[model samples]
Structure formats: C-alpha cells, structure tokens
Target: MFRISVLARRYSTKPITSYFKLFPQNFPHGGPPQDSFIINPKHLRREYRNLQSENHPDLNGSAILNSEVVSNEASLSEVINKAYTTLKNPYSRIVHFIKVNHPLHLDLSRDEISKDLIKKFQSKSTQSSLAYKEILMNVLEVHERLELATSEQELEELEVENEERIEETEAEIADMIKYEIKDWDELMMTAIRLKYWINIRNGIKEWEPGKPMNLTH
Candidate 1:
C-alpha cells in the first residue's frame, strides 16, 4: 500500500513549480476552464454519502423507480469511483492533472530504445521480474560515481550534466501529452541519477565509521 502522507511530504520538499506555469489561476480575458475547479476531498466524500442515501435500492415506497434513474445512479457511482482513485494516488493525480489541464502535442524522434542495453538490464535481474531490480541497480551505479566525487564543486558539475536533459524532458512532457516518447526513458535514467546523488549526499553529511550513534544529530 502506498502512503499519501509520505508522498505529500516528498512533493513538499520538491514542489512542482511547473504546475503553476501549466495551470495559471486566471487568463487576461476570460474565466478558468470548468475542469479547473479543484475538488475538495471532504466535499466529495459528503456528496458521495448523499448520493448513496438517495440512490439506495432498498429505499422503496410509492416512488416510481425508473430504469433511467438506476442507470444515472450507476454512472454517477462510476464517476465517484474514478474521482476517488485519481485523488488517492499521487502519480495518477499528476497524470490526470496533465490530461485535464495541459494537453501536450509531442513528436518523438526515436522509434526504439537500444535492445542490447535492455538485454543487459534484463540479465542483471535475479528473479523473473526485472523492472524494479534494474532501476535499483542503475541507482546503485550512479551512487557509486557520486561517492567518488570529492568536492561540492564536483557534485554541482555532475548535477549540471543532467540539468539540460531534465529540462528537455520537461519540455517534451509539456508538448507531447498524448504520445509515447523515447524521452521518457531518458527522464527515468536522469531520475535514477538524481536519486543516487541525493542518497550519496545525505550519506556524506552523516558519515561515520563504526558507531551506530554516528548518524545521530
């Protein structure tokens, strides 16, 4: 199970500045889009409860229970389910925000990723599932490089090497909202690098030899 509070904290540490760029508060000429109205979790939950009370098939009297009413209730229930699912998951929420607010027009240059690299990543897998293991291995390799980095200047330089690619990927995401792109693979690679560097930097800050208490403040 995923922890929403943990994700919210992570995002707070690295807030999405680009979100405001993509979804501005107001335009110069007109009002915001209909979908731009933010759905409050409390309000949604209340609405759902109210809907259930009204649509409960058990609630029977002289009221003519039409088939159309039942169908509409089902549809509303489906919408409620979808809304809850999207709101609960951070990744899904992000994707939904992009889809609703800023549709992209992406054009991919590469047709296929390197098969040899894919094979190498696959071979490194100890079990039948290769994906998680491959990501972890990539992160480990980057962390090793970061450990060898001597100074803050070296770390900054390493970060600069990735900055351009990260920016390009962000732009690509903005443009190609609907289409698949080879750029996503590049973004994942860069994310792994960033994650490793972050871990290594934290390790250096809390460096210690033998004692368990060395990591304490």
Candidate 2:
C-alpha cells in the first residue's frame, strides 16, 4: 500500500503548492508531467486516509501551531478532501490534467456538448472534430435506447455493452496520454467520450422502471 508520509516529509518545511503535489506517488513524473492514466484505487484510498490524518485541522490545532497555521491547516484539509475526490475518478483527473497543462484543448464545456454543438461539429472535417461528433452521436443513440428500454434484460444488455465501451475508451485514453501527448485535440475528444460513457454507466446503474433516464454530460 502507498502512503503520503513521503510527501509529508518532503513538504513539511515548505508550503504545499498544488493538490497534485499531495500525492507524489500517484504522479511520479510530477503533477501535469505524468502521462499515465491508470492509478491503483486501493493505494489512492490508503494515501488519502494518510493525508487526511496528517492534515486534519483537529490534528494540527492551535496547541501545535500559531493561529495562522491552524487556519491554513483547515483550508489544506478541505483541499486534501477535494484532491482525493478529483484523483480517485479518472474522468475528473483528465479534466484537471488538461486544465492545468493544456487549457486551450478543452473546446467544449459540459453544457456546450448538446444537439446544437453536435450539428456545429459536423461541418468541421478535422479528425478530432469528426471523432467528437461520432462520440456525441453514439451517446445520443444510447440515451434514446436507454429511455426506450422496457425490460430489465434490455437494460442489462445495454449495461454490459456500455461497460465494454467504457473499458475500451479507458485503454485508448491511456495510450493517447502516454504516446500522443501532442495530439491534444484527439485526446480531448477521447476524454469527452469517456466522460459520457461514465455518465451512461451511472444512469444504467440508477435505472428504475418507467423513470426517465438521467444521463448528464
């Protein structure tokens, strides 16, 4: 199991810079420099617990530090919780990575990836543009099918297929991030696809007979 004690010791005398810095083990290349997409969830959870334990405001109260440092510890504790959440989910991790390293590549926001945006992308001929459009279309198709699905078996079959799609996209994302770092456009499109697939997976998991599908981008 991985622990955050190394990170704590390394930064004990200095101000913590970024959330990514709190878990050096997860991104050995250092924050945005890390190219890999996979992380061990078990390790992440363990590291999170260790980090929270060391940084929790109660653990670093005024008895051990000045008022200013205690206040900062409270804020740091909150940030530690958020960092754990962002790094635990692959989709959010990708978003954070791009936001930090390649801000311009995020062409579309969640609200912008609707029917109107799909039609707009159709006019563009770039590979990334086409790929984004195809992903959006597929997500729409799946949404329609999910809304129309009548029986548990139909939903189950869709769940299996969508899970497979999610796995395939995850692998593609890992390869792209590792070897196609310069292809920001393609990577962004693939990341968007993965996001939608994850949303669909959640919708399937929460499905209830006769209830409308609740798939969010």
Candidate 3:
C-alpha cells in the first residue's frame, strides 16, 4: 500500500527551491507551486507530513544558521497546503486539470454571443437570468431524454451527445475568457450552460433509486 507519510518526508527534505521547480507554471501568481506529485489520497497525506516536518523550525535546531530558512519553510508549507486543497476537492481537481492540460488556444471571445440573444437575456426579469433559465431548461430537456433512452446503446449515444455539447460549450467559454469579454449577458449565458451540464452529469450518477451519490455530490 502507498504511504503519505513517506512521500511527505521525502519531498520536505529536499531544498525548498526544488518544490517550486516541480510545478513552476502553476505558481505564476505567487509564492510556491502546488504539489502536483500526489495522484491519490495516500500520496497526498504523505506529502503533507513531509512538508510539516521539514518546515517546523524546531526540527533544525541550531544546525542551520540562515534566517531565510524560516521564510523558505513557510513558503514550502504553503505550497503543500495549496496542493492538498486542489487534490482534496473534485471540482477543484477538474479545474486544475483543465488549467494545466487543456489547450491554451481555446478562444475566449464575445463573438459567441449574438446581439439578438444578448438583448433577450438583458430584457428578462430578475426571477432568474433569462440566459441561465434557458440553459437550465435545455439541461432538463436533455436529462429527460436521457431518462427515456431505451437501451444501453441508446444511453451511450446520449452520453456521447451530451459530452459533445459540453465540449462545444467549454470551447465557447474559453473564447470568452481569452478576450476578457465583460458582457454579463454573454458571460452569464456561457456560465449557465457550463453549470447546467455539470449538474446534469452529477445528477446522472445518482439517477438510480438507491445508489449512493458520486463524489461530486
């Protein structure tokens, strides 16, 4: 069986700088990079312990004379903390995976939202944003269709279709994000679609009468 304690100790003993090098791109915004090495909970806990041990000032005693040791240790600990945070949560893990591996060329532009649609979304009442409401309706329609799916083959087909829709929607959102589009009308529409599919996917996992909820739930 894998052990988190061993992994943590191993990582912590390495020079603090080494951790940053392990995931340099992930820390573009700040201090130290997260521990991307963890692939499972066991690995996660091990890394956590290693970081705590190495950073504890008392461990070094009088052996190290540099004042920077404290700061470095603090930074290392923070990285471990962020890693745990990302790995522990399913949604965060998905987002992190997208950030790390998805193609950067994915467009983020306002062009995906036509002017007529924007007007419709903006003109609606506040009960729920018009765009979001529509997206939810779409999701519901798809889900109902999925429920009526006749066979394993039919269900598989629907799953493929839904997956395609999600991919297309995500690409549209990427375009919007890339261009820094500030149009609430456009952003909300894309966000609504994204959230709708996410919920639908989660819902499918629990559709069976007595099955336990999936990790996302």
After superposing candidate 3, which stretches have Cα over 4 Å from the reference? 1-23, 26-134, 209-217
Error of 2 at 112 (Å): 5.2
lDDT of 2 by residue, 104-217 (tens): 323234444323334444545586467676777899999988988889999999999998998788788777767537665456666777889989988888888788986886
71 Cα displacement, candidate 1 (Å): 30
Clashes of each: 3, 0, 14
Looking at candidate 2, the ten consecutive residues that score lowest on lDDT are 7-16
TM-score of 3: 0.42
Q: What C-alpha root-mean-square deviation, in Å, does candidate 2 show against the real structure?
A: 10.2
Better of 1 and 2 by lDDT: 2
Candidate 3 lDDT, tens digit per residue, 1-217? 1133542343212222222222223322321123332134565466456546755543344422233333554664565566556544433433443333222211112233233333456566564466456655676677776566555676567677766776677666555544333553455455445555666666554555343333210
81-161 in candidate 1: lDDT tens per residue?
555565433233334443333223111111122232234335654652366466566556545555566666766765665
Q: List TM-scores for all candidates, in order.
A: 0.29, 0.69, 0.42
| Model 3: lowest-lDDT 10 consecutive positions | 101-110
Q: Supply the global lDDT for candidate 3.
A: 0.46
The candidate, 1 or 2, that scores higher on TM-score is 2
Q: Which candidate is the best by lDDT?
A: 2
